[model samples]
Target: MVPVLREAPELSLWLLRSPSPDSAAAARLAVRELDDAEVRRAALFVRPADRVQYLSAHIALRRILAATTGCPPESLRLGREPGPLLSPRTSRPVLRHPPVPVHFSLSHSHGLILIGTAASAVGVDVQRTPTIEAVRVVGPALHPAEWRELLALPEPWRPAAFAQLWTRKEAYLKGLGTGLVRRPAMDYLGLGTDADAPPGPPGWIVRDVLVGPHHAAAAALAVAVEPRITLRTLPVACLYDGDAGLPLSAAPLLALRRRGSWTLRWSLLERDPPG
Candidate 1:
């Protein structure tokens, strides 16, 4: 047995987190596990830009697994989806082999990076900080209730409007295992995802994260349960510096890079920040 290390029953979830995002070595390591070249051949479909992006994110997630179980990183593969939210080209050995019920998610906004892996439906979102003007412009595009809510905030507080909305959407998508291309929007009513959360989404649960100054983030539980997210802030220098792609792990989030790896120091904080 891999040992059930984490179980977030409330969210119907199990989580894994890693601080470093091993970008450089991930491609080489992951490919080695594949028995055929089709996985690599599939890479041709993904634009070079997107191909590289997916690889970096996958490697980071693999390393998170390695750190915990002492398993090989690339040995864990990315799931191939032919659906609308077709993911970046990568390996999926873990699903076939030893059956590691682990699934992963990746999100990046500005330079901050976030990745998540869980046994249940998981979602995450990261947004670059917005300006008050930008929030004003985006408010109309948002749901009517969100529009009124944000519009009512003071000028300086407006910047946070988009950030909060973006994070919630991102987190919701991550939980669904579908990227933003699916067009999922945020529910104005806050769900009590973190016990202290304001009434938001009724069916789903969400929590905002402050991993970096210029970043706003959120994560969600799937349709199964109303999740309560416990925030984890790892010592990912990339988060603070906005240059390094340093990853975060713990509670299902990991950071991987193709180059130098990071052994992150993260924290699990219970917070109820008033929105």
Candidate 2:
């Protein structure tokens, strides 16, 4: 049996890289904990890559929540709630009958998945750097000031800049529960590099995350005061053992050991200055 968590952290973020094509059998075994609805949803994806990404993300989310809540991963009930205050039809993921006050969000893009858990509402997103054409196409849909800022950036820098802004915006919106259904252009999260965060939503802290050089990631939490953020990456091999992705206990230090070279390390990538 997988060890259960004695207490949930105030805030935490986990990053998992999707399995390579060669590890198909282990990847399939890793996601056996997903519920029937999740399995159906994953099957709906037309592309094989999309299906794998969905499977990888849901497995990680369930395993993490199971460890924290002491609930069987397959038995946990997850559902969508109406986002923010107004969008009645927008879907925001929430625990149906959580054993604790746990709020979480999940996002996956181009084989990278990010999951964030907190005592209060939290949202996270990861995205591959947008193409220059993508930036041009989506730029005008963002806040006017953000668009102008994108226009001002050097041609080569625009994709990264837009990606950072997009992740922050998505994270905040996801926390709000409104998502893009509420219109992303309504909020103005800026591109400034100073310590102070650019004016945007109130009562939430959004910050960029370092996930190596290929992807731009960010997480948002609804807190009056900023708390320390714990970031870690799980090697895909850990999932190869069983449906329990990380073999962890209630101890403060989260560790995973496999028979050979693969292991889990709770490394804090870097602490970015608080906004």
Candidate 3:
């Protein structure tokens, strides 16, 4: 399971609903609350089925982000990999906040695409339980030893761990903004693990995050804070309504002990790497 990390000053977390809610009113209600600019911006990528879902998720994100830093909606911008596109209206707020070089990564499964974010270089990823066949098809990211680690895990946790590693690597990719264009093995290994891999792509802090219980996830950021990976679970309702903007305020969020697909996270954890 990707452990959820909350309370990192260097990093923050947000969830984009795979679907807005049971009713269209919930989706539309969330959309109407978004900044007009954010809605128009997301429209550029809207697909036939993506129209409603896209609006609900992105708009929710903009509201939450604006609330977090107390910045006006007009000044904030969402990046392609969930990057921060804050325009600042002018150069002063741009200089003051300097946009913080936020990075984001996303993945979906079982109708949910979990997202995580951080400053500068950051990566986030999500996956539902891939088929047994899919596990065999992961390519070179999993070395012989890593596969051994996966195999060593008990039956219940194996698939979850597989999802974790895959998402962690993918999150690192998103952090690099290279997507799948670059090979993760060539860049990182056991990302959130104690293996002592390189920091991150040029000028980024290398961190990992696990969001859900059955799910695995990793995030890459720019700053090097001793791994204070805090994890929390927010409900689809609260996330879409922009309530997750407050730090460590997910007390009202659901406390999911187990789920088929859960998010996980690994920050620059406080413990020393195993040597």
Quick one: best lDDT, which candidate? Answer: 2
* Model 1 spans > 4 angstroms off: 1-56, 67-70, 82-98, 181-186, 189-203, 223-275
lDDT of 2 by residue, 41-136 (tens): 988998777887788778778878987899988889999887656556667899898988899999998888888899898989888998999999
lDDT of 1 by residue, 27-68 (tens): 333434333443575376445444544444444455555554
Query: With candidate 3 superimposed using the best TM-score fit, by how many Å does residue 21's alpha carbon deviate from the native?
Result: 5.7
The 10-residue segment with the lowest total lDDT in model 1: 266-275
Q: Candidate 3 — worst ten consecutive residues by lDDT sum?
A: 87-96
Instruction: List model 3 lDDT by residue over 93-117, tens digit each.
Output: 1112434454444445444445555
Candidate 3 residues lying further than 4 Å off, grouped into runs, are 1-9, 16-25, 32-53, 79-107, 139-145, 151-158, 191-210, 236-275
Structural similarity to truth (TM-score) of each candidate: 0.57, 0.81, 0.60
- The models' CA-based lDDT, in order, is 0.48, 0.74, 0.49
What residue pairs are clashing in model 2? 83-177, 84-177
